[model samples]
Target: MVTSTLDRASAYTAAAAVLDPEVPVLTIEDLGVLRAVQVAEDGSVDVTITPTYSGCPAMQTIADDVATALAEAGFGPVRVATVLAPAWSTDWMSEDGRRKLSEYGIAPPSPPSPTTGDRRNGPVQLTLGRRPELVACPQCGSTRTRELSRFGSTACKALWQCESCHEPFDHFKAI
Candidate 1:
C-alpha cells in the first residue's frame, strides 16, 4: 500500500516524541535511537531503532513506548524493529541531547575518538586501564571530577562526583 507523505510524517512525529525511559528529558529523536518510521495506507506503522547497546535493559521499554505512541496517535498495527548491524554510538546522539543531559545535571558523553570511528564493532574493552580522562562536572564545570563507579543509575552512565562543588552526578558514557 502506498503511504502518503502526511501519514509518514504523522507516524514519525508520534514515534519521535517517545522519551527514553532511562532519561526522561530527552526524546528518542534526541537520542538518535528513533532511526526510521514508515507508514502504510492502512495506518500500519513500522519503526526501526537501535539500542544504546545490545542487551540494554531499556530496549524493550523503548519499543513498547514507540508502539504505544503511534497507536495513541491513531496509527495502528505498529511494529518496532531493532537493528544492531551498525551498532549505536554516542556519536549518534544529537547535540540537543547532549545539551539536555548537561542541563539535567548529568555530564554528557565526549565525542567518540575520531581515529577509531567510535569502535562500534569487534571485541569491546571493559576497562579504561589508564588514568581516566578528565570529565568536567555538570554541576560545577570542574575538571577535577572523579568517577565514583563505573556503572551508574543506568548502564550507559557512570557515577561521578565533582571535587570543587562536592556534587555527585551521572556521566553518560561514550560508546
Candidate 2:
C-alpha cells in the first residue's frame, strides 16, 4: 500500500509510542532510544534506535516492540536499525521521561555537566573517564544517597541507599 507523508508521521508516532522492554514506565521516545522513524512512499517503515549500552539485552526486545507497534498501527514491513556511532547518553532522555522514571521509583539521569556542553550531541564519552554524578533518592528526594553497589537490579542502574529514607533504590546511571 502506498503511504503519504502524513501516514509516515503517524507511523513514526506509533513506533515511538512503544515502551522500553526493561523499563515499561517510559516509552522508547521517552528514553530517546527511538532515534528516527522514517516511512517510505511504499508504506515501509524504518526505525533507528540506540542502545543505552552496547551489550544491552533489551535491544532485541525493543526492536521487536517497535516493529510490532508500527505494524499494529497499520504500517507494514518495518525495519529497525541500531546506531552506536554517536553513542547514547542519559542526557538524551526527555524531561517527561525523567519525571516518569522518578515516579516509577527509579532515579532519572542527571544532566550532563556544562563543560560537556553540546558534546553529548556528538561523539562518545568514555565511561571510565566519567565521574559518577550525585543521585537523589526517589523515595525521600534526598541528595544524600550512597552507592550500595556499582550494579543494581539492572545493568543500566546502580544500587543506592538514601540517608534520609534509608531506602534502597535503583539509580539510572548517567552515561
Candidate 3:
C-alpha cells in the first residue's frame, strides 16, 4: 500500500504542526520558519527551514523535531534543510503567531514602519510621545518592570524584572 502525493502532503502538514521548543505557543508555520516541504517520488520527505536568527542553537533542535515528526508519520527518510539566503525576519510572523507569543508571556514584534527613512538612522528611534509603553510583566501583567538584560533565554528575547511581582521574565525583543 503506497501513499499518494496528497496523503504525503497531508502528512507533511501534520508533521509541521510541532511547535518551536523555545516558544511552545507557535508552530514553525506560524513563525514563517518552515519554508517548504517536498515529498519525493520515492516517499522521502524534505523539510526546509529558515532560522529566526543566525547561529541560533535552537535550529538543530527544530530540525530534529521535524525529522522525528515526519518519521512518526511513516516517512522512511526525512531530510531537514536549512536555508539562509533570504534571512528570517520578525516581519514574517503571522497575526496568530503574535497573539500566541503574547499569550505565552512574550511580546511580539511591532508592525514595520511605513517609510524607509525609519531604517536609515541606524536603529529606529522613537520620539518620547511615540514610544511604546514598557512591556508589562508577563506573569502578573504589571507595567512596573525594568530591563535586567538585553538578552534573555534566547537572542530574540530580553530579560526583564518585574518590580511589582519581583519575578524575572523574558520579553520578546521588538525587532
Candidate 4:
C-alpha cells in the first residue's frame, strides 16, 4: 500500500496505541517496549520494539499487535524488529504510563537511587545490596503496603497487599 506521510504518521499512532496483552492497562509505549517507528519511502512500515525482559512472553503478542494495527491502518509490508541491546528499564516508562498504572491499581516503579549503578548498562543483575523501596497502595493510596511476594501475576510486577484496605494488588517492580 502506498501511504502518504500523513497516513504513515497515522499508522505510527495506531501502532503506538496497541496495548500490552500482559498489562492491559498499559500500552506498548507505556511499557517502554516501543523503541522506534519508521515509514519507508515505499510505504512499508518498520517498528522496533524491546522486550521488558529477555524471556518475557509478551514480546510475541506485542509484535503481532504492532503488525495488525499497522496493517489495519493501511500500511503494508510491516516489519517488526526485536531489539535486545540496551535493555528496557522502568525508567523509560512515560509519566503518563505511570499515572495509568497507578490508576489501574498497580504501583509505579520507584526512581533508582543515585548511589547505585545504572542497571541498563549491563546484563540484568539482581543485587543483594539492593535496598527495598517503599511502594504505595493503589487501593487506598496508602504508603503502608507490604510486598506479599517478589513475583506477581506478571514478571514485571510484584504482589503487594494494602494494609489499609487489606486489598491485594500488583506493584510494577523496578528492574
Best by TM-score: 2
Task: Give per-residue CA lDDT, model 3, range 38-62, as digits (tens).
Answer: 8777888878898877787889999
Q: Which stretches of candidate 2 lie over 4 Å from their true place?
A: 127-132
The per-residue C-alpha lDDT of model 2 at residue 50 equals 91
Name the weakest run of 10 consecutive residues (lDDT summed) in model 1: 116-125
Q: What global local distance difference test value does model 2 have?
A: 0.86
Candidates, ranked, TM-score: 2, 1, 4, 3
lDDT of each structure? 0.87, 0.86, 0.76, 0.85
User: Which tens-of-lDDT digit does each residue in 30-106 have in candidate 1?
Assistant: 99898899887777888999988889889899999999988899889999999985778787788899999999999
Candidate 4 structure quality by residue, lDDT tens digits, 37-97: 8888888889999998888898899999999999888887899999998888777788899
TM-scores, one per candidate: 0.89, 0.93, 0.76, 0.88
Q: Superposing every Cα of model 1 onto the true structure, what RMSD results? A: 2.4
Worst 10 residues of 4 by lDDT: 111-120
